[model samples]
Target: MNFNRKQYTEDDLLALYRGILLPRLIEERMLILLRQGRITKWFSGIGQEAISVGATLALNPDEYILPLHRNLGVFTGRNIPLDRLFAQFQGKTTGFTKGRDRSFHFGSKEHHIVGMISHLGPQLAVADGIALADLLDRKQKATLVFSGDGGASEGDFHEALNVAAVWGLPVIFMIENNGYGLSTPNSEQFKFASFIDKGPAYGIDTLQIDGNNVLEVYDTVRQAAASIRQNPRPILIEAMTFRMRGHEEASGTKYVPQELFEKWVKKDPVENFEKYLLDEMVLTSRSQVAIREELKSLIEEGLDKAFAVPMPEPNVAEELADMYRPFAPALITPTSPNTTEKRFVDAISDGLRQSLEHYPELVIMGQDIAEYGGVFKVTEGFVEQFGKQRIRNTPLCESAIVGIGLGMSVKEKKSVIEMQFADFVTSAFNQVVNNLAKSHYRWGQNADVVIRMPTGAGTAAGPFHSQSNEAWFFHTPGLKIVYPSSPYDAKGLLNAAIADPNPVLYFEHKLLYRSVASQIPDEYYTLEIGKAKLVTEGDDISIITYGMGVHWATRLLQTMPEVSADILDLRTLLPWDQEAVAQTVKKTGRVLILHEDTLTGGIGAEISAWISENCFNYLDGPVIRVASLDTAVPFSPPLEQQFLPVQRLQEKVAQLLKY
Candidate 1:
C-alpha cells in the first residue's frame, strides 16, 4: 500500500511506528514475566497498541489523557521513562504511586494522566472536569478519555456524555470496541449497533474508524482536537478494535472463540503498522532489525533496574501519610463587632458567597443551582454575583459530578458540590469512597473538595429525599464529616470545610434550613472541623449528638426541668471530640449517644464503643444510645415521626439520668 505523507513527515511516521512497536514488545516481555512469576498481574495490550499510540501522539503535550488498562502505548507515546513504568508494574517505590498501587491502576499528574478505576466509566466524567477547568482558565486544552464497549453501558457513561454535550467542554470520548467485557460479549452489553448512533442522541459529534490503522487514528484525533480548540465541545470516537488475549494474565482466553482470534491476528495493529512503514520506505529491513533489537535491549535494561529497586516498607506513619494535607483546625472567634441573625440556610449561602470572593478560583456546582437557584436556594443569588462559570448547574448526574469535582481538584482547583439531598448520595458512593476519598492517599493528590449534604427527616421528604446518612461517610477514613445544627456553626463549619485540605462532607439538616436561626458573625470566620461544642454545662448526665439530634436533646431538656445534663453537639462525626467525650463521661459518670440514623452501625455505635473502651473506669453506668429504628424513612408522617428519635431521646435521657 502506497502511503500519502500530506499530514505527517517521514520522521513522524517512523516515530509512530516506534511508538506502536515499543508497547507491543513491552507487553510481550510482560507476558513472559507473568509466566516466570516476576510480576503479579499483566493486562495485555498486544493487539490494540495502534489506538493508544496514535491517539496519544495526536494531542498537545499539556492536554490530559485518562487511559484504560490496555493503553500501555499511551504511556510510551507520552515518553514516560520505561524504567519507572517497569518499577510501577513491579511495585517498587520509584513508581508513579510510590508502590502504593500496582499495574496500570494509578495516575500521574506530572504526566497529565488520570488513571481509571475498576468501575470503568467515571474517568469519562473526570475528563470533562479537566476540560472544564481548562475552559474556565481560558486554556484551550482537549482531554482524551478511553473506555471499552462494555464499559459504555454504565450510568456514568450516559451522564458524562450528556453533561459534556450540555456544557460544551473540550473532550474526546474514545471508545475501544473490543467486542467483550471480561467474559460477556457485546451482544449482552448494549442494544446499539454502534456507539456513534448514540452520539447524535446526546448532540455530540461522532465518528468511527478501523482502530488498527495507526495513521488514521493519528490524523483523526489531531483534526478533532483542532476543531474542539476552535469551538470547545465533546466528540465521541468509536475505535473498532479487538482484544487478542485474555482480560488479564490469569484469566485464560477460553471464552474467546478461535475464529475471532484468527480474524484479529491478520489485523494486528503493530504488525500492520510496521508493514505500512516498510511499504512507504520509511523503514528499511536492516533499520527495522536494528530498531527492534535496540528496543528489546532497552526493555531488558529497564526491567533489570526495576527489579533491583527495593520493595516498599509499609509502616503506620507511611500508611497514614498523604491522606490529607497539613492544615491546623482553628476555633471560630469573630473579632468583628458586626453580627446578624441568620437562618441556617442563609448562613450557608453567606458562607459560600464569602468563599467565592475569598477564593476567586473556587467553583460551585449542583443541580438547578444556576437560574432556578438550587433545590433549596442555597445558591439563589450566586449566579448573578459570581456568574455561571463560578456557580454552575449540572445534570442529574451524581456520580459524574462528584468524579468531576475530584478531577478539578487534581488541577489545584477547589470546589463545593451540593447533593440536593443526602439520600441521593448513594448514587455517588463509589466516586466518594473509592476515587475522591482515596485520591490523596493513593497518589498524593489531595481532593480539596467539599460536598454539601442536605440531610435529616423532619420535612417528610420520603426515603429518597430525607435521610441522616452521615454514618455512611463517617466510616470512610480519607473523608472529613461535619454535621452542624445552629446557623452560627453552619456558616463557620461550611467555611472550614471549604478551606480544608481534604474531602469534607458538610451535612446541613433539611429541617434546620429555616426553622433554626442564630446570631452569626458578619465577618468571615472558620470553625474547627473535628471539634465539639458544649451547649450546656451540667452534672447529672451527658448527651452527645449532632445535627437534628441536638435539637431533639434540647427539646427533651426543656420538657424535663428537674434533670440537669450536659448537652454536647459533636459537630464533626469522623473525629468526634474524644477529649470532650472523655471529660463529660468522667464528669457525669454517665453518657448518652444520640443520632437520627438507625441504631445499628450508626455513628452512635462508634461513640458508645469508644466510651466503653476509653472511659470504662469513669463510667458509672453503661453508655446509652438513642437513635431511629432500623428501617427506611417512611413516607407517612406519623410513621416517620414514630421512626425518629425525638420520643426515644426523651425516654433515653430520663433513663440515663436515673441511672
Candidate 2:
C-alpha cells in the first residue's frame, strides 16, 4: 500500500475522501427519490466519483468547471450548496435555474461553473472560449471541461481541442471513459486503442490514468493545472473507469453483463479510496465512519428542505416577455444630409470598431478574423487596432466558436462571432438553437453575444456558400434576428445587437458588402432591433421585404410608376414589426412579403400567418409571398438568378397590383 505522499498532504487526501463521499451519498439518496417518484429521473456516477472529484479538487476555486451530466462529484468538490443541488433535482423555484431546468442543466455564476446541456460535448468549445477570455484578461487560470466516451464521438470535442491547441488556450479536456456509452461499449465506439492518443494529433499533451484511483487522478490533474498555468497549452486526460449503474434511473442495466458489473462494483471508487485512507493511516476507521454518517445526515437535511420549497409559478406571459426583452429605442441624432457615404462593408467595420471602443470586454472571434481580416474583410484592420487577444482568429470550427462565444458571454463579457459564410452557420446549428438561444430562457442567464452571419446569394457562391438561412433561426424563441438591407441600417443595427442583453443573429447580406452605399453618422448610435423601415411611400399595395429583396422590390416598383406600392423594409425578422406591418397593410389594403430564402418554411410563412391572423379584415386582397424557389441555390449564373425570386418579383407585384 506504500505510495508517493509528496504530491498531496494528509489533509489534502482527507479532503478528497470527503469530496468523493458526498456525491456518492447524494446520488444514493437521489435514486431513492426517483423510486418514490419524487424526482423524475436520476443519472448516477456511483463508480466514477474519483474522476469528477479529484480533477475538480486540483483547480483554483475561482477557475471555471464545465461538468457533464454524471459529474455530481464536481458540484460537491466546488462546494455547491447541497440544498440548491437537491432543489434543482426537485424542480423547486429556489433551484439554481429557478425550476426551469432539471438534472445537470444548471450553472452558478458565483461558483464559476457552466451548467451541463443535454448535449455535453458542446461545452468543450465553450470552455475553450472561457479559457480564451482568461488569457485575454492576463489571468493565470485554466478551465476544466468534462465529457464521456460517447460524447467524444461528437464533432464539438474535436473542434474544441483543435481551437484550444492552436491558440494555446489553458483548457483541460477530461474524458471520463466509463467503458460504455449507455448500452454501447467502447469496443463499438472507436477503433483507436485509447482516447488519449487522439490528443497528440491536435498537438495537445495527453495522459491516460486509472480513473478509479482517487490519489492518481488528483496528482495528474494538479500537475496538469500547474503546467497549463506556466506554458498555457491544452491537455487531454482519459480517465479509465466504468458506470456501474444504468445511464438513467429508467434505463435498466440489462444491457450490461453481470460479470462486468460485479468486477466494477468490487473496484467502487468511494469504497476503494476509504480503504486506501485507512491503510495509509491518513484516516482512522472511526474517522471514515464519522465522515459517512456526516454526509448521510447532511444529504437528508438538504433534501428535506429542498422538497419543501414551492414550485415555480407557471407564468407564460412573463416568460414570453422575458424571452425577448424589447431593446430601448435608440436616440438617433439627425445627421447632416451631406454626410459622407460609406459602403455596406465599411459601415459594418465601423460598427465593430465602435463596439470594441465602447465595450472594453468585447471580443471578436472567427476564422481569418485577426491577421487576415476575415474572408470578406469585414474585420479588416481590427487586429492592428485591438490586437490578436481581442480580435481572435480561430480554427475552422463553427460550432465551437459559437459555443466559445456563449461561454465568454456567461462571464458577463460581450462576444461578436462571425461565421465566414451564413451557410456555414448550419454547422453550429445545435449550439445556436439549443445552447445560445435556450440559455437565457432556461437559467435566466443572458448570452450577450452577437453572431455576425454573412448571409445571402448573388456572387454565384453555390449551394453551400449561398443561402439565406434566416428561416432556420426564425423559429427559435430566445434569439433576435436582424437582416439589414442598407448601409445605415447595417451600422446602426450591428451596434444595437451588440448592446442587447440577449443573443442576436445579425445577418449581413454578402452581395450588399460592396453593392450598397449610403451616408451614415460617425458617432455611436443604435436602432431599435425589432422595428421596420418604410423605404418607399405608396397606397396601392405594401411590399414588405428585407436584405437583397428590398432592392429587388424597390426596382420592380420603379419600373411601374403607374402602379404605386409602399415598400416596407423589415430590417428585423424574428420579432418583426407587427404593428408597422398591420398599419401598412391596413393603409394599403394589400400585402406582399418578399425574401431571398426558400418559399417553404421561410420567414414569409410567419409574416403571412400573422397578417392573416391580425390584418385579415383590413386586407383588400390576399396576402402574397414572393420568395426564392424551394431548392438550394444553384451554381450556374443563369440558374442562380432564376432560383432567386428577383426577376419573378416584378411579375408577382404586377399580379398583386391587379388585386
Best by lDDT: 1
What is candidate 2's TM-score against the reference?
0.96
Worst 10 residues of 1 by lDDT: 1-10
Candidate 2 residue pairs in clash (backbone atoms < 3 Å): none
* Candidate 2 lDDT, 352-379, residue by residue in tens: 9998998999999888898889999988
Model 2 shows how many backbone clashes?
0
Q: Rate the local accuracy (lDDT) of all candidates.
A: 0.88, 0.88
Worst 10 residues of 2 by lDDT: 329-338
Runs with alpha carbons beyond 4 Å of true place in candidate 1: 1-4, 329-333
Say which candidate scores most in TM-score: 1
